[model samples]
Target: MTYLANPTRYSDMTYRRCGRSGLQLPALSLGLWHNFGGVDTFENYRAILHTAFDQGVTHLDLANNYGPPPGSAEENFGTILKKDFLPYRDELIISTKAGYTMWPGPYGDWGSKKYLVASLDQSLKRMGLEYVDIFYHHRPDPNTPLEETMAALDLIVRQGKALYVGISNYKAEETAQASAILKQLGTPCVIHQPKYSMFERWVEGGLLDTLEKEGIGCIPFSPLAQGLLTNKYLQGVPEDSRAAKPHGFLKTAMITPEKLEQIQQLNALAQERRQSLAQMALSWILKDPRVTSVLVGASRPAQLLDSLECLKNTNFSAEELEKIETILK
Candidate 1:
């Protein structure tokens, strides 16, 4: 059966400007970093995608190395796109990244012009799209010249392969430098994707301030701290949990007793706010105007809906904020 998107999808969700750019993204965007890979069930993947779109999540984030097999996520997403989202292509903001160990050779990795251009070409082919809404250098290449990387992004836009360009996992100073170079090339850096959550507040130091000054949008990944901020682990790590999976990013050591104690306190506060711990964590990130969107990955449609509920009560009283800070401290 062909899936039909809900007509009133745009009614409830909020959209914010991407920094100073004219483009706007939904407050919540779907990320295909997990569960949409080739290893996962296609039926579940399709359901999650449909649910997210029906609820007005217009952006779908991807990367070259997202899947267990590196590029399998893009391939899986491509299959779904051709099947379901082809008609709604104009309504979506699809983005992907490169800059990790995608292949064995030196040209296959890093921030070289050769690598970025080739990676995006392969990405476009896999996704069955002529162009992506945004293409990102997955991380800063310490060895590559900033000019080389930024110039590659500029070339991509000029070649009509990507509408915009961005950087991920870059610090405040690197972002500033990259933004300047892209501006000089007449292709501004429109957004920055970083790891941010109550458990990971590194961006709060100076990166957010830098982005504000540079007029770049911020979209935080891991806003729920890889499910640590959720109630799923309060009792104990499940056998099927990411932490329990030996090869997954979330390790058992990360869920320390101290972390669980903090999560318990935070969960209590979330209950007072009438929101789940996951919802509150997302809402907390959006409390800042600097955040253009929160990138969330969901294994199921219900999980996506639960995260969406954060938008219902984004308000945080000074006391609540202080209490959260106290708990975090």
Candidate 2:
């Protein structure tokens, strides 16, 4: 059955505008970085996509090299788009990115006119998309001139392949400078996808301040710290978690004794609030006004639903904040 026919199933999720723009994305958007890769079974992929849409996750984030084989995730998601999400295209905020190593050779990756344009073309073809809602430069290309990268992004927008443009993993000054260039080119940057969580506060140092100053939206990936903020590692490393994946970003060494103790302390605070550690971690990020949405990855429908439950109690009293800060220290 087509997924759009049951759109009402997701009516409960709140939608927020993308940085003063007219585009309204779901508060919690689904990302296809890990579980939806090519190596995963088709049944699990289909179920996650179906469950996400039904759970009010209208936005899906992807990149050119999301698969173990690179570009396979886009291909897999493209199949789902053709099979399930095509009819409801207008209701979805599908985004794909370029800027990482995708192909061999010098011009294969990074933010150059040659690479960005070619990457988007390949990404669109892979995803079977005529136009993606947002196109992001996956990361900053220090080697490439800012003008070249910005111009490439500008051209992508002008070519009508993307409605808006975004950047990821950019520092404060770089984001500010890129926003300036994008605006000058008549294609204003709309969002910044950064990594933020209780365990990751790098953005809080200055990146967020710059985003607020520039009127750009922020969507934080790894909001659960690659599942560390979740209960999956409470006792010890679980056999089926991201830590178990051979090439996983979250390593087993990350579960140091000190980190485990910190988690245990934070878990007590979560229990006090009558919420799971996962929900608390998500809510902690949402408390910041600059945060437009949280990008999350899920292996199952139940996990997605459980994360969304963070909305039920997002308010963090002064005392709660104090308790969390004390624990972090």
Candidate 1 residue-wise lDDT, 160-232, digit = tens: 9999999999999999999999999999999999999999999999999999999999999999988999999
Candidate 2 lDDT over residue span 100-142, tens digit each: 9999998898888999999989999999988999999999998
TM-score, one value per model: 0.99, 0.97
Cα error, candidate 1, residue 237 (Å): 1.9
Which runs of model 2 end up more than 4 angstroms from their true locations? 1-4
- lDDT of model 2 at position 124: 92
Off by over 4 Å in 1: none
- The C-alpha lDDT values of all candidates are 0.95, 0.89
**Cα-based lDDT at residue 193, candidate 2:** 99
Poorest 10 consecutive residues by lDDT, candidate 1: 36-45
